[model samples]
Target: MIEILMWLAVPYIVIGLVFSVTHPDDVRSLEKQVQTQLPAGADALSFGAATLLWPMMLITGPVEEHCDVG
Candidate 1:
């Protein structure tokens, strides 16, 4: 048990060491990929209501865009 943990921890410790050696801009880019793709402030003014009201359509497309609008 202890021997398996020692071997598993060795590479993880090496990875942590390498992460610390990485450049700051590269690290920031990595962190930014985890968030949503919204632009800075256009969401609330433009698409906030649409996004909140129709999350499914936002994720997927509309079932019929030209169906029945009078």
Candidate 2:
């Protein structure tokens, strides 16, 4: 079970690393836009959490667009 879970997670981790490194501009843009819009205490945590939980934001859409709706 542990091995299987590791296998599943590897791809996501690789993709996240590649996306973050390759498209830093998008991440920065999203971070800046979101900081102003997020609740006062949530700004910092939200970005890091969003990156880990929804790595696809690097491809699927802007982090703010996906994360700020809530």
Candidate 3:
């Protein structure tokens, strides 16, 4: 069970890291939507959340497009 979960998490973690690094502004924007405080390491926090919620993020599309629902 643990091995299966780890394998799943590996992809998410890798993707999350790439997204966070390449799209820091998008990650910060997401952080702003969920939290009141924008601390120094908030990017890391957002990246962690993104890893856990990758499926939702993938379904929702990019942050810019996701927010532009009018």
Candidate 1, which ten residues in sequence have the lowest lDDT sum? 44-53
Which candidate should be chosen as best, given TM-score against the real structure? 3
Stretches > 4 Å off in candidate 2: 34-55, 62-70
lDDT of 3 by residue, 1-70 (tens): 9999999978877887776677666666677655556567666677777766666776776777766422
After superposition, the stretches of candidate 1 with alpha carbons farther than 4 Å from their true spots are 23-70
Order of models, best lDDT first: 3, 2, 1
Q: Per-residue lDDT for 1-70 in model 1, tens only? A: 9999999877765654454344333323323432245446433322332322233433444323423212
Comparison by TM-score, 2 against 3, better one: 3
lDDT score for candidate 1 against the true structure: 0.40
Kindly state the number of residue pairs that clash in model 1.
0
Pairs of colliding residues, candidate 3: none
